[model samples]
Target: MDALHAWAWRPDGPAPAMADGPLSGFVLGVKDVIDVAGMPTRCGSPLTAPDPAAADAPAVARLRAAGAVIAGKTRCTEWALNDPAPTISPFDADRTPGGSSAGSAVAVATGGCTATLDTQTAGDVVRPAAYNGVVGLKPTAGWATTAGGRAVAPSIDTLGVLARHVRDAAAVAAAIADGPALFAPPGRAAAPRIGVLRDPFTDRVGDAVRACLARAVRAFSAAGADVHDVSTGVDLAAVHAAHRVITFAECASLHRRRYRDHAERYGPRARELIERGLGTPARDLQEAGAVRRDAAERLGSLLEGLDALLVPAVPEPAPPRATTGDSRLQIPWTLCGLPSLALPAGTAGPLPLGVQLVAARNAEPELIAAAAWCERVLGS
Candidate 1:
């Protein structure tokens, strides 16, 4: 591994690039959890054998076809859970780069790659990108397939991208998305209507993040965008609780066989999640599903008349490497299956701070356009 510990696997020589396409010159890093032909998909876990994948995952194939070079497999939190990866923030070595897509974010941050394939169950993609000062785009759930990757939370797992710019991330996402046409070149929005989320979400963030969000709101307003405060109406705390129940239950379902036979091989956090999931009652899982649906509906309603809802991407800047920062600010949108983008807003001292922009389900085009506009305003 390099000093930053970004890559888990690198080719003996540079990976070949395609002659030409939309992403022709882009160097892409695949998250270790995702398959890349001829490379082992270790998922940052010792339990998985080092047998090379026979084929590229759908998302990887799509990006390759669009002419992105496969640089290598980047590290991920073990099983894409809470366990921290070895990668550290490029800005501050002692601070976390976030997870489970830590390597993906770090790779993009340090120019190790132009873009990276990432996934989000809770805040894997966005959080890391925020900490590393890159753009993380989590499309609406199911917009991009999760077929070839290990599942953390089957229903909520989303394929996303981490890159240095909104356009780069948007381009990578468009190439792999189910509805490619939905991501037409991100045009600058014309006086976009944006909502600044308050109460449940904002109340939890620390001073630095609050300042970052405040600056973002002001920038958008100054840029001629119609900005106003808004609420999700749904109880976000309840939604977060439901998200855990579902994530744990589904994750346990996927790893039951392996966990039962080689329990000692798993990391503490991953092991705890699996154990809790195994103990959760089926009725509770069902109820959690219900809560998810209800919350999604309410949040979707909140998006009407608004191009996007803005909020802090993380509760605070990246913390010590002992753990990934909190994911509460990101869970509600992920649970609701809305498209969200994290952009570097400003710095919290030396640490990078980000603000998230959320749009209704299947509205990635609008989300990207709005984000592009905000990216210009923030000058990030």
Candidate 2:
């Protein structure tokens, strides 16, 4: 009945009110993709066999060590793909909250928890946070360990952070990073050089979203950021195709046995994706990897003199709840394995809008710094 309160776990006992620690007193919602001891990881699908994990995921273990409460497993799209979860957004009942990390975003946005762990293969983390008016941080592909989490694509599936504030996101990130120095506060730094990405992706956005982004750029300029347009110069269509091939092929491989035996249990969308993956030739996957490498190089060149790249977190505000919303905006960065931070910029009509900041691999600190700056100046 409680959409925000998806479930609860007290693995070590009730969350304590510890006075000191990176995440002391923080209640975190873990996406169903991540394993939490004593909880059955349903992964937002009735098809999941609901296995109780033997141990906490590495990220979960790190957070628990840092004094964060293992709040519960949040809902996700079935197997972290096109299948929709049963959760609804607190902002508007009619519109989708975004997925496959929908419940995690909704929990943070609604204040049901202080923060939440999300996962992104495409826009699962960034798009949903944008739609729900929260901050979502997808660190570099391998920054946080995914040992005990369900995988969509082993190569790209990343554990991410979603919260109401950039600082909260950073704190959780640091805890999970297993490296305390990744998010050390950047003190009184000069304005960062920001790159604005535009193309067919920008063209697909609606008027309100365009205005929201324009205003955000203006705000950054007023705050002394060096902003400019930068082109990735890669064939985006091919890049997207590459991403799909990697994700679908890997997903099918991971579930090949289960899907073969219990095909009827899968939702329609999951079935479609898996079936496509099953039919894909190995040569296509190899070619997709080549495309991914090429795009990564081009993307690196685009960021040569920039601190971060700016883009709409999604094409528009949250759409009707029937769908999870478009993922086109966040796919490029995800494919490139760059760290991206999505911060609520403003609103378009009744729903929230977000802008994303992307940085090079292991450049999470820069991403966090720019996001914090935007949060302070833009007042989201």
Candidate 3:
């Protein structure tokens, strides 16, 4: 019943609103890593000073222009990395709510906000939505401007949304995207060509998640979707390895000076990542970029005839508060910079399970439509 920890700060009265548009009544929680004019962006780390920002991040500005009420700044993991936030899952207080967009997901799931602006370098947005039983949408890299936000991995870090419904998530995305039609809900496809990915990444999910995926597949088939089992054919392991190297290197690059001067201020996980990045050879970083580009091409090709690729959002339901759930299932899509959507599919006892849908780059409309259809079919 106590979820105050989810918010880093809240206004004494209603937060200011902008001219009315599609999101006139929407209440949005901005992640701590993103700037909100007049509010301090702490990024849930002691490394940052609590200085009020002069302007809003593009994502926040766009949402505000669309008439969304800025609820407050939600908590995030330190620098949106390995460290977990203090937020607790509404489903079970003893379990983790996922991270580093932990507070964003928790706010949406608990009805504290209509939607939230979040950032995802790996599985931060979708993983947390899955764990908290909400809807998450990560658009193509560069689709939503990351200006005015802290970068975890500039090359891969992306702005995203978490909402109680797929349509709400789509609305938020459409507002900030370069193309107004990016996530505008389109007419439902008569038969969505859904490709269910079967790879080492998916093979690692636990029984509950496996069963949840199976149930989703059945629902899609029953709803007249043309579902087929498929593979990306790219070396997933190599892609994941590349993701880590790139993320760490970029993060370290961003924090090099601060870390060098005050290493004691960082959490253990963040410190370890920076150290790894500091030690990584330039040749290794370049090779990782090559691997990433090659995998992106192969994965994009795999979506040639498919409306969306499906997979479990996480390996299992939210675990104990000690750590966030695994991000293996989401890393490949994120690395490829493809658009993905996560929807609550079922439950494991008291916790929730989710399925992710991915589409080719710049295919946010298709991805949103497909997710909406699945959301309907699953009755989530």
Predicted model with the maximum TM-score: 1
Point out the worst 10-residue segment of candidate 2 by lDDT: 3-12
Q: Candidate 3: worst 10 consecutive residues by lDDT?
A: 10-19
Model 3, 44-79: lDDT tens digits are 998788889999998898888888999889998888
Ranked by TM-score, top first? 1, 3, 2
RMSD of candidate 2 to the truth, in angstroms, is: 1.8
lDDT of each: 0.90, 0.84, 0.89
Candidate 3 residue-wise lDDT at 122? 95
Q: Is candidate 2 or candidate 3 better by lDDT?
A: 3
Question: Candidates sorted by lDDT, descending order?
Answer: 1, 3, 2
Q: lDDT by residue for model 2 over 246-267, one digit each (tens)?
A: 8889999999999999999998
Q: Which portions of model 2 show Cα errors greater than 4 Å?
A: 1-5, 8-20
User: Candidate 1 at residue 30, lDDT?
Assistant: 95
Model 1 regions lying over 4 Å from their true place: none
**Quick one: RMSD of model 3?**
1.4
Task: In angstroms, give how far residue 149 of model 1 lies from its true place.
Answer: 1.1
